[model samples]
Target: MRPFTYEVPSSIQEATSRGGADAAFIAGGTTIVDLMKLEVMNPSRLVDVNPLPMLGIQMREDGLRIGALEKMSDVAEHPEVVANYPVISEALLQSASAQIRNMASIGGNLLQRTRCGYFRDVFTPCNKREPGTGCSAIDGENRMHAILGTSSSCIATHPSDLAVALVALDASIYIQNGAEERVMNLDDFYLVPGETPDHENQLRPGELITAVRVPRLLWARRSTYLKIRDRESYEFALTSAALALDLNGDTIRDVRIAVGGVGTKPWNLPEVRQALAGKPLKPETFAAAAKLAVNGANPLRHNGFKVDLVQRTIVRALMNLGGLA
Candidate 1:
């Protein structure tokens, strides 16, 4: 890692005062350290936010409130989280490894960078790493890259499993810039990789995420997170789905769907949810809804498989959650 000065700010105001283009907020140092070692990121100063009162996991009457600094392992294994939000628990347990989960914070996981090979290698031209430089993955080995919400500037798949589950639950992120605080839906917090691929999220300079709130939903209790990858464990998802269903008898009353590892962001499928809303929970209905997932998919040479894989993953997730399979 590059030589850098570190500061542990006692307050959010002090941290935001030092945060800018040259400084980075470090919590778990999981993502930042990896990029620093690869020489992909070089921040002059590191502002530690671990002591800034951002560590708590509470269940309120409204919903589940997860502090940004809460460790991934703690959240995943929390009794309340596992009982109420199986999708969230499963997503966390399925991410990275036990050692990483023990160290990574919830906020850090949500803001983790893409795992694209080109993006991690400083020598390669990755638009996400250096905008306008070029996206080598577009024409290179891009089997793990994105197909949905992809722009010509970048096709890197979003790497967060927690983000996918939270977006499906319609979670809201609380952010603080100095003393000013704001909340935004998790779905809107991540910007699509448009012309500016380097701009991955909606977090402004000097802003720090405080907590993520997931509203209570009847479907949330029946949710499931299903991932398909090259290996069984300790692997990133090639195509994954976070599915929640509220069923009335054999019919679907409501549903929420979000996908990861196949899009520039956590891809939500409202159309599919709408298509299956009042339908009977059956294999045919699941397949029909799944087909709508790839409505605007722009698959590349080596990643055309994602278009089909995304649909299959969604169907399987729904089946797994609904006990239809």
Candidate 2:
């Protein structure tokens, strides 16, 4: 890593004050450190937010409020998160290895970059790394790239397991910049890689993510996360699904669905959710909605299997959560 100055901010205000254009906020340093070592990212300053006040898991009248700095392992194993939002807990557990989760922070996880090989290598042309340069994954090895939310500029998929679960649950991000604060839906925070693939999210300059609020949904307790990968552990997903269902008898009352490893961002499938509303929790119902999961998909040569794989994964996740599989 290149030479850089590091400062530990004792408060959120201090953290944001120091984090500006060429400065980055580091919580666990899991993502930022890797990029730095690769020389893909070189910030002049690093503002450490670990000592800040944003570091707790709490329950409030609104919903489950998870502090931004809370470790992934801790949040996954927390009584409230594990018992109430199994999807969230499962996503975190199924993420990186035990050691990485112990060190990675929730906010950092949400802001994590794509895992596209071309994007990480400085030698390759990646629109995400250098805008207008070009995207190597477009015509190269793109089996793990995105099918949905892809533009001619880039097709790298957002690699956040936690983001899929949170987006499915309609979570909101609490952000603070200086003394002002704002809240935005977790789904709205991520941007599709259109012409400007470098502009990834809706985070404002000098803003710090404080916490994520997951509103308590009656059906969330019956939620689950399913990840399909080449191997069992420490592998990024090829196609993953996060599903929550509220069933009335054998019929579905309400459902939420978000997919990962298939989109430029954590993808929400509202059409699929709408299709399953009031429908019987049967194989036919799942198969029909699963088809809609790939409604706008544009698959590459080698990644065409993902079109069908994502659909099957969605059906399997829903069935497993609803106890119909």
Candidate 3:
């Protein structure tokens, strides 16, 4: 890793004061360290935010409030989270490895960089790694890249399993920039590559994520996070589905779904919701609605399999959650 100055700020104000383009906030050092060793990221200073008061996992009548610094394993293994939000728990348990999960923070997981081979290997021309250098994955070995929400500038699939589940739950994030604080929908926090591939999120300089809140959706209790990958353990998802359903007898009352490993961001399917709402919950309904997931997908030469794989994964997740298989 490159030599850098480290500072552990005692307060949020002090940390925000220390933040800038040349400085980075480190909590678990899971993502930051990996990129640093590869020299893909070279921050002059590392501001430790572990001491700041961004810690808690509270269940409220309004929602489930999870502090940004909360460890992934703690949140995943919490009694309330496992009982009330199976999707969140499963998403965490299925991510990384048991050891990494024990060290990674909730906020850091959401901020993880893409696992695209080119982005990690500084030798390659990855738009996400170095803007305007051209995306090597576009015409190279891109079987693991994205098909949805992809731009000519970048085709890297988002690598956060937690983000996909949270997006399905309609969660929001609380952010602080010095004294000002604001909340934004989790889905909106991730920006598409459009033209600036390097600009992945909406977090401005000196801003820190405080917490994430998931609105109380009792139906979310009947949710599942299903990830499909090459091997399984410690592997990234090729296509994963986070599905929750609200059923009235045999009919669907409501549904929420967001897919990962196939898009530039956590891809939510509102059209699928529209198709299933007030309709019967059956294999045919699921199959038809799942097909709508690729409405605007632009599959490339190698990743075209994702187009069909994602739909099948969605249908299987819905079936597994609904017990219709």
Q: Give the TM-scores of the predictions, in the order they appear.
A: 0.99, 0.99, 0.99
> How accurate locally is residue 45 in candidate 2, as Cα lDDT from 0 to 100?
95
For candidate 3, write residues 199-311 as lDDT tens digits. 99999987899899999999999999999999867899999999899999999999999999999999988898899899887889988998999999999889899899999
lDDT of 1 by residue, 1-325 (tens): 7889998888988898889998899999999998999989999999999998888899999999999999999999999999899999999999999999999999999999999999999988988888889999999999999999999899999999999999999999999998899999999999998999999998998899999999988568899999999999999999999988899999999998899999999998899989999999898999988999998899989999988898899888888878877
Q: Which ten residues in a row have the lowest lDDT in candidate 1?
A: 316-325
lDDT of all predictions: 0.92, 0.93, 0.93
Q: What does the lDDT come to for candidate 2?
A: 0.93
Candidate 2: segments with Cα more than 4 A from true spot: none
* TM accuracy, model 2: 0.99
Best first by lDDT, ranked: 2, 3, 1
lDDT for residue 142 in candidate 3, whole number 0-100:
92
Clash pairs of candidate 2?
A: none
lDDT of 1 at 11: 92
Question: Model 1, stretches more than 4 Å misplaced?
Answer: none
Error of 1 at 40 (Å): 0.6
